[model samples]
Target: MKKIIFSFVTSVLLLLPNMVKADEGMWFLMFIKRLNERNMQKMGLQLTAEEIYSINNNSLKNAIVQFNGGCTASIVSPDGLVFTNHHCGYGAIAGLSTPEHNYLKDGYWAKTRAEELSPKSLYVRFFVRMDNVTDRMLSVVNPQMTEKEREAALNREMEKIQKENSEGGKYVVSVRPFFQGNEYYYFVYQDFKDVRFVGTPPENVGKFGGDTDNWEWPRHTGDFSVFRVYTDPNGNPAEYSPNNIPLKAKKFLNVSLKGVQEKDFAMILGYPGRTNRWVPSYWVDQQVKYAYPAWVEASKTAMDAMKRHMDKDKGVRLKYASRYASTANYWKNRQGMINALTAHKTADQKRDAEKKFAKWASKDANKAEFGNVLSDMENYFAKTNQESANHNYLSIFFRASRITPLVVGFTKQLEQYLSSSSDQEKEQIKNRLEKNLYAYYDESYYPAEVDLFADNLKLYAEKSSSIPSELSQVKQQYNGDFKRYANDVFSRSIFTSKINFDQFMKQPSAEVLHNDPLAKIATALLTKYYQKTPEEEKLADTYAKAFRKYVKGMRDSKISTTLYPDANSTLRLTYGTVKALPADKRNADVKENYYTTFKTMLDKYKPGDPEFDMPARFVDLYNKKEFGRYLDKDGTMHVNFLTNNDITGGNSGSPVMNGNGELIGLAFDGNIEAMAGDVIFDKKLQRTIVVDIRYMLWVIDVYSGAKHIVDELNIIQ
Candidate 1:
């Protein structure tokens, strides 16, 4: 262990000074002191590296957490007040909403702690510490081993390391691979499961601009939500209970009401999701040519199907609101990626870089180790490209089959109940299955399921190269008429209706399940997928091995200077400066000032529109010019600002701190021109959109009249 630590620290110390850019790289916190502290200081950082990340004492890392494994959040008050993006909290908010109250549309404010609502499941995990265990992990791996053998050996060591660090499950420990298996890091986290929703602006303010303004610039969405973490009286992780008290955080960030100006230093601290900046051009071709188009089409199909039901019934809207948002967001994102990647010519750029790398590696010693890497990757991609559309279309259809999951879950228990001779045991199993089926029904309503099922079948036929042999008869009988086939199946399938499903479960039997149309589809499709998995996995392994060698060779040849690992939802620091964008380069209609104001946001408002409607009180306040101290000196309320910080998916809700480590804004979205950013960071065009902290405070104090909640925060002006 000591040797591993020493080797990791030495490697970190050897990092080249000028290799990394101030505006690029999602850096690990552990090496901040040795590698980034000086550069960060020169860029206007005020705190020491230890103050940013330390295991023994309170530091900035304590405040930042992985919110539910998907998004990032920060501790803002000593009472465990958590701050994250509105869309990040949308699922929980939608779950708590109803047609009558509609907390999502009207927004909600907990005036007191007692009024805060807890979702059925919502949690926040604090970063405890991290250790680079690369050497230790590689000790069990060797070139002679097959991929499966290497994986098994590594998993054994990881399990032991994780268990040792878990402290009897008190802390969650995970070891994630980085740099294409070239490095490994151990992350420990403590989760508090008693988080409750506190306050959120109405969707008008929170998600303003909606789909129309999704990735566009000059952004004015508030995009922030509030929650609080609660723990046992002893300040340990605990489930939700009335007796649980608000967690007294070891450290919390103070909100800086003094808004950031253009050229002001901006740094983000959070768990960024992933970036594929080093991918080969061949894979990029696959994504652009085949994979993404299929995903975009299938996602749009699901979104439209859900919207048809949601728009007509308010209850359905509340139920499927989050689903529609998630589907639409990604659908648009893929479309944007296709356009942006083509316009930016990212594949061409990647080929150019690869050419340079090849020239550098032409020498004898380098050639022996890395010569076949690029060729092997090319071969793998060439083969996979043929099936890309088919794979994605089929995969999407399987996932869009919501009730299929319930059927699978209930199938195992039903089989058990059938085999049991004891009446008591059989009855118990039946009871368990019924309860869970009901729960799944509520989560995925019957109307939505029927629509989604029909949509999936229609899309699968439209895009997939071949139909499952089991379903071929049905397809042939209908003469490939998807609508007719869908209607017939949905009408017969018990899975589409809750009452029918429940009644059928009362006399559950394998014969009935085997005959069921939905079950047959799930079984046929899943079996077909698994049957092809071995070959598919072999091709994937080929890509993985080649990429790993390619990355290592690049490092050895000095073709790749900065070697920061891609994000795997781990804590990282991305620093840059608040900047402006050229809205139009041809005519230069707008230079896109760093800040957006309420007046501009109001200009885009449309009455009674789901995306643009705001409460009358908010408009009234604006008309009266009821500006508080939160306003700028020019008497305008700043809504959003732009920064050049390097970030991606999970960085949503990350605190955009100033040079002084004070919260200036919450990093939310990236500009549209930089939609190709996940593949290649365009330093000239990429911009991180942030909700100015003052806007959040103004809505809390003046709009929601939740000054008591505001008083808890350490507000710095």
Candidate 2:
């Protein structure tokens, strides 16, 4: 969610005399600032002087823990109890429950350590250290090389780096490019293969108002989950084992009672996904006018059909809640962004900036690359702009249905094939496939998806008449004749399963064999008047190249930015400072701060309103002012905090640290205003939200009465 700054007034400056040069320089300055803001600086964060001194003096890096196999987390206890967001551990919790044992609905608690539930597959990872390997790695690649040559060189460099760093174990090492092409960090991490679920609250508490309250503030969703890591008899990471011992983290955060107050210094460390701050203005306008709106409409239509089916089918709802929630969440966020973008006049500003840059580049030789790239991007957008929105929709729906599952299945099968001699591989593959099957069966509607494609075909037919009168008759022929279309197109395919798909791929004319249901729909839309069109393939290749170029450009630019490579199951450290800021145009004057009490929660309550109803447990806790042992720095109530840390999807369970590196909170959500933080993060507006460590301990001590687990924590009150 990159927020673009667009101002129409600035657009006119592009044609102005002296102002054009100033505007061009300002754009570059902005770009540099953005890059520096997101760059990794080891333990260094964007903190105030006092905050920096605090973390440098007191922070304990070992407190951070990777959780439940995939997500990031931090350990609060020495005996193995770990803390992370409820959403991070939701899948495992949801997976273990049946209709009768609806953990998601009623929640679950292990009364004793012996009764704690073991997840079939869960693990945690811990970061060891980061080493500077910029020159050592990039020395192998020529800077002036082509994209393909650069990619190959990078791959070779990474292989060498991994080999040299390998400890002759299961540890993974990754070389990450940072600040565009200016720096590189090599990270080594050990991933624990065994982790187990400990506890979670009911949906009423964990999810609270569900989607209605997802990204909103003054919130009361107790988004927390508990899990424990286990090691084998030899103290080695392994699969679930009864004989396994609790993991002893090299570093763990001591639980703190002093919580964040207004303007408190805080920071979050986690992996954040993509951002689009550097995109051209034309691209931004296209997304605003065409891309986001079209997808939202398509998603709405699909959701309606899915929800209608779910209402009549309980099994479908139960199995597809995760999928639905994922889609619904995106839909909500995108809508919010659309509104915010318009309010901020982002598109207009971007257009103005682009024109100014172009004018400046016309004179400057050294800075010509900036304007040239901008021009290329705009040209590319113009060529593919009309089809881009529909392309995304097609990709999403089709990938959700067929491609993703195939890829996952293929990966699992490959792992199994490679480990044919190991019995554990077979067991792991079986478990993975079983879970995937449930996911695929629950969320995918093969017949309905095909029908949706059929509908899209007809819609395209109606629209294609505007393209050319020569193809008008052809468009009319397929306007309502999907039955014939499907038979003639899809029926010619042999893409039923992996085996068939693989066989088709091996054929000399494999492209001809790709006439599946999805392809039929694509062909109907792309081709005009009985003539085949290569537009689809051409657009696909262009997009692929664009993405690759973007990645390559980041690697070569040497700009200090956080646009790093993906996590290759390796340990990495990210640093940023914690600060509260206004939510851009919406709450520009109001400071985003901590802990809206039960009082604030109650104020939003409407007795007859089912959506706003508080659960009895929450109400009771509120009435009791069950502050328990948790209290803020000022001895007032505690809730959440804002940090200027950059993070992403994989950073779910990451630790939020103070300047001293002590664990103050567990990083969870970013403010709704900062939804676009992933791309073009704004230090002024972006803040990572976290559940206070004090609050977590209070729940364990006062609510669950899990003193045994509580005793494990080194509580620093």
lDDT of each: 0.84, 0.56
Cα lDDT tens digits, model 2, 494-555, are: 33233444454345242443334434433433343224257644544444344434444433
TM-score of every candidate: 0.96, 0.72
What is the overall TM-score of model 1 with all chains considered together?
A: 0.96
Question: Compared with the true structure, what per-residue lDDT tens digits does model 1 show for residues 69-112?
Answer: 79999999999999999999999998888889788888999989
Q: What is the C-alpha RMSD of each candidate to the true structure, in Å?
A: 2.2, 9.4
Measured by TM-score, the strongest candidate is 1
Give me the candidate number with maximum lDDT. 1
Worst 10 residues of 1 by lDDT: 583-592
